[model samples]
Target: MTARPPTVRERRLAGELRRLRESTTALNLEEAAEGLGWSKTKLSRIENAIRKVTAAEVQQMLALYSVTGPRLDALVRFSRTTRQRGWWDVYENSLPTDYATYMGLEAESEWLNSYTMGLVHGLMQTEDYTHHVARSILMRFSPASEVERRVAARMARQRAWTERADPTRLWTILDETALQRVIGGPEVMRAQCRRIIELTEQPNVMFQIMPLAAGGHPGVVGSFAILGFPERFTPNVVYVENMTSALYVEDEREVHTYALAFEQMAAMALSPEESVAMLERLARQ
Candidate 1:
């Protein structure tokens, strides 16, 4: 009885549909609805991604907007995936809406560019580190079981880089403080460092350390990640998180700002070989 929340695919399809209608037809909402012989509310809901659209419906709308050729075929093909459920769907009820949405996007991303100021990225975290981090922040307000659920979800998220047949390419620039701050204690940090070192050996993984000597840089403000997808229609998303909630930046200019910042930080950070040496040295200490 409740409307389903839009998945990343649905949101992409909806945005494209709205763009086409506005740019091509140049019709106002009421007029568009009248032309489609549908109630204004129905069109509104579809455009807002509150309702699922059928492939047939997509064709009809494309026809109305005078869309033809490859773009039309692509949209119709994309519409079929709008209703497909992701593995993360099972944990949706337990996870925050924004976090769940992030998981969905991460799973489908072809590559990731991450800059971390205080901790290891979730996709690269060891189970012990994940448990410690989850409990430290969540235990004050969340029940132990809920905390465990979150931990499980995080661990599952690692599959994007680990278990997949074609693993997502990951490039992370970690602040030196993140390496120095012993998360779960000496032993845990050692194991975590070892884990990171091992992952860096993989062809798809790239790790860099922004040494303390770097002094000041654009990333000094905070940490963020940019998710790039294989398809052009599904634009890159920049994810920024704080203590309680997260923000997804999709505007071209805003995402470009984050991307540029990441590139600048990457230049300031240690090279991949040097970073692995630093990890190995830390693991010993």
Candidate 2:
């Protein structure tokens, strides 16, 4: 069977497990599996995060590996929380794995830096625009009911930027073409642009427009987002989406590349005040 990449939970579990395994120099994979009375494949899967690692399983492995005290307690606690579900859990089977992962990460993000060349970023989209776009893209293959469900899911993602109790700072840079494009017709575009204007009023939100004259910039290649987490240990991620799949770059070097691109794009875009004025003018047009 083809091995797929580990999900967030899997990666966390695997990292901890691998650390534990390496700490005991005498404990090789075969020896560890034999001592735990488990198959080598099971041990490998658990270590690689190719399979679910339950609290009970973790307890057994920790006990066999001679783990004790606060460290064991912390690992067990982490194991328990891994089973917890996020808001997007309901759409697990509906959304692609990559998209689902993106939502999960976005939900935990403390800050987001996004650059879009031709479309409004997902977190900033209005319901009408979301519906129109989803319908146009999905109507060919998905039923109307399914398309509506997807739209609802998309709208739900907006909570990351809207919930003031724990607001996620969003810095979005859009190409002027995105504002001029009539997504759901003039009325919908008007409301959409107006919504963007209103969103700019929030302290946690920022907007910039790359004018038509800022022709051929680094972001002209595509769109992407750099998501930062509050936890110091959780490294920032750069997420890039294509027509069929998405890429998550966690390595510091690659993430830095995306960060530099966003900085350059933001530099060329209109100032916050200018962007709001641009939106207002587009809405009226």
Candidate 3:
């Protein structure tokens, strides 16, 4: 039988757990293992994320490591959510394992902040616009027919913005260059820009632009996002996309850095009231 696919999140958690263990003083681990009445092997598996680690055990481990402050609390909470299923599980057969994990995170996010360097966020994209983007992106691995289905799946994912009873809130920052890049030509770009204007008016959505004239910005780091949860039971995480792979960061410090950057982007970009006006102006051109 095939091994269960390791989620990008799981692999990361395991790596971090192993790093913590490797760097831990033997005496500290010994004392903690003894107090918890757990075998060293068992602790190892937990740290490796090879098996489930209960919140109680994680709490004990954190205590042993003297990991106090909000970081500890956040780690414990993240452990609890590590096992919860994400909606993208249904499309497991369609997407690559790592991309499946990304979809799950997207599905479960309570609040998502995205900055686009080249195109619009998928959540804010119209079906045609998303199709154009997905097919172009998948040109390497998939044939034309397969790409169409994948494009459909991507567009379906966007339905979360409008179809959910309680939709995930999205705050997206698009660059003026991306909008001006003319996705499907002048008519299509106008539609896309108009869609942005409409979505920005939703009570739960915010759309804004970073004018090329705004010059350099926090997003000069390229595109990234922070996915926040409504429940305190989970730690907020940052998602980063690189050329070869995507990464998830759950460390509160890292998450906050991205979150602060997002806040700055929102503040420095147009206000929501003016953002709509800005989009309207762009769509007209």
Q: Which candidate is the best by lDDT?
A: 1
**Lowest-sum lDDT 10-residue window in model 2:** 1-10
User: Taking the tens digit of each residue's C-alpha lDDT, what string does model 1 give over 34-71?
Assistant: 88888999998899898888999899888989999988
RMSD, every candidate, angstroms = 2.2, 4.8, 4.3
Residue 154's lDDT in candidate 2: 87
TM for every model, in the order presented, reads 0.91, 0.79, 0.78
Query: Model 3 RMSD to the real structure?
Result: 4.3
Clash pairs detected, candidate 1: none
Q: lDDT of each structure?
A: 0.88, 0.81, 0.72
lDDT of 3 by residue, 29-126 (tens): 55556766898777666655566666787778767666677867777777666655555666788776556777776776688888888888877788
Clashes of each: 0, 0, 0
User: After superposition, which runs of candidate 3 have C-alpha atoms over 4 Å from their true positions?
Assistant: 6-45, 54-84
In terms of lDDT, the poorest run of 10 residues in model 1 is 1-10
Q: TM-score order of candidates, best first?
A: 1, 2, 3
